[model samples]
Target: MAGKQALNIVKIKKMKQDANPITVITAYDYPSAKLAEEAGIDMILVGDSLGNVVLGYDSTVPVTLDDMVYHSRAVARGAEHTFIVTDLPFMTYHGSLDETFRNVRRLMQEGHAHAVKMEGGAEIAPTVHSIVQAGVPVLGHIGLTPQSVNQIGGYRIQGKDEKDARRLIEDAKALERAGVFAIVLELVTEEVSAAISAEISIPTIGIGAGRGCDGQVLVFHDVLKYTSDYREKRFVKTYANIGEQIRNGISEYVNEVKTRAFPAEVHVFAAEEGVIDQLYGKGKAESES
Candidate 1:
């Protein structure tokens, strides 16, 4: 197979202009990143969703910057050409501007991320601009920002009413003006998300925000049945039931071991009869001495 072409801000912008739908998937480790790249995915987001998916956390708020950096580096090693965008975890960017810059820099320099994504709208535009000014690409995330789940009162669809829809559109515009290369709209009303995508010059990557987006993103675990514990979401279309297959395979292995069917001749290393006899003879001589 031909190697994937390197993706950058220029290429992504061109894709939006050409009306091509971009593909993005979350990957937290080397194997996941390699698989995503092999599948011709356009972008790999090292999302703080890892907190819930990988680390057994209930929400993204508990994820630290260090956790993001560690996973981002692992993903970077596996993805050669696919664009890597890592999330600036909660509180990392919500603090002072200097703190935001520091955290973003760590993601870029230490984590080897190509871009950084942060949640918010007009309120965080200034920080987005500052990060862009420092020569780091920013991907703005609006609508149902997970970091503010407490403030938003849970993972509900945003911009439902006319007033809030207008606000979402304004936020997308503001983020574009602030110099974000792209924006991610999560759990937003379809009409409002389409309007925001239309108003913004940059690409709009939707999670649960419907089909009117310039692109779409889904968690890797959601796409493949990596875990059976998660509650099904409206947006997730599971392509494979890998979790079931894994469980079945493990059960087979357990049965084989219990029956002593495993490590049957083919699984064992054999020794030459002559070599075995020579070793036994040597032991006999040593005992006699």
Candidate 2:
């Protein structure tokens, strides 16, 4: 769990047995994922959330399979211990049911994601079923799915009404039947989320679905305070203001350079006596040292 072997079934099984609710964060690159790994986060999702968080896009619709693959590979390099899951971007899966198999294989084989996640339930069950049948682990996503944000009319809470709530439950069951290792319930009612968690045999990891879920996941940027300008959501519990720290550090560095006060002794390199003599007279050593 502490080494190069990425998150494995043993860890996931123990995670399920512990009942402590695993915490997952979206990490788009090596540095961010390395930070998440060092911070002891339970999982790393190379999410298409990167469209907004990393690529500065308005929505996940613009995120492509190649974009996800490139970032997932970078994240996989750093989050060697944390479970790394990548999203199947728009059109790749929803375009055609048969195409889902081809795209999912490319994700696992090329992107290096342990599993793939897709939004929707009963409507996407056959696709999910086929992927699992082909031996790829699938994680189901329900509730306020981002890929269908246009159809859903912006990010909003789901499963509040009886019809929507029942549909959410049936969607969970459908995904469970299709053999997903876990399900992500985002922006759904907490009570409904609890019911689904209770009913489902596999793990239910939630975001904006409240504490009743078997686990919770958040985008790394949101959790780390990287997107300070973005609206804070009810589900995001920021653990640190790393963005501020990063900004301050950069600012201090700029100030140091501006004042010519940087290159502190410990930060500067040393040269051999003859090398220094060859490069300059004796005064260079005195001033540099």
Model 2 residue 226 CA deviation in Å: 1.8
lDDT of 2 at 233: 74
Off by over 4 Å in 2: 1-18, 228-230, 264-289
For model 1, residues 192-255, the per-residue Cα lDDT tens digits are 9888888878899999999999999999999998896857999889899888888899999999
| Pairs with backbone N, CA or C atoms under 3 Å apart (clashes), candidate 1 | none
Cα lDDT over the full model 1: 0.92
TM per candidate: 0.95, 0.88
Residue 240 C-alpha lDDT in model 1: 90
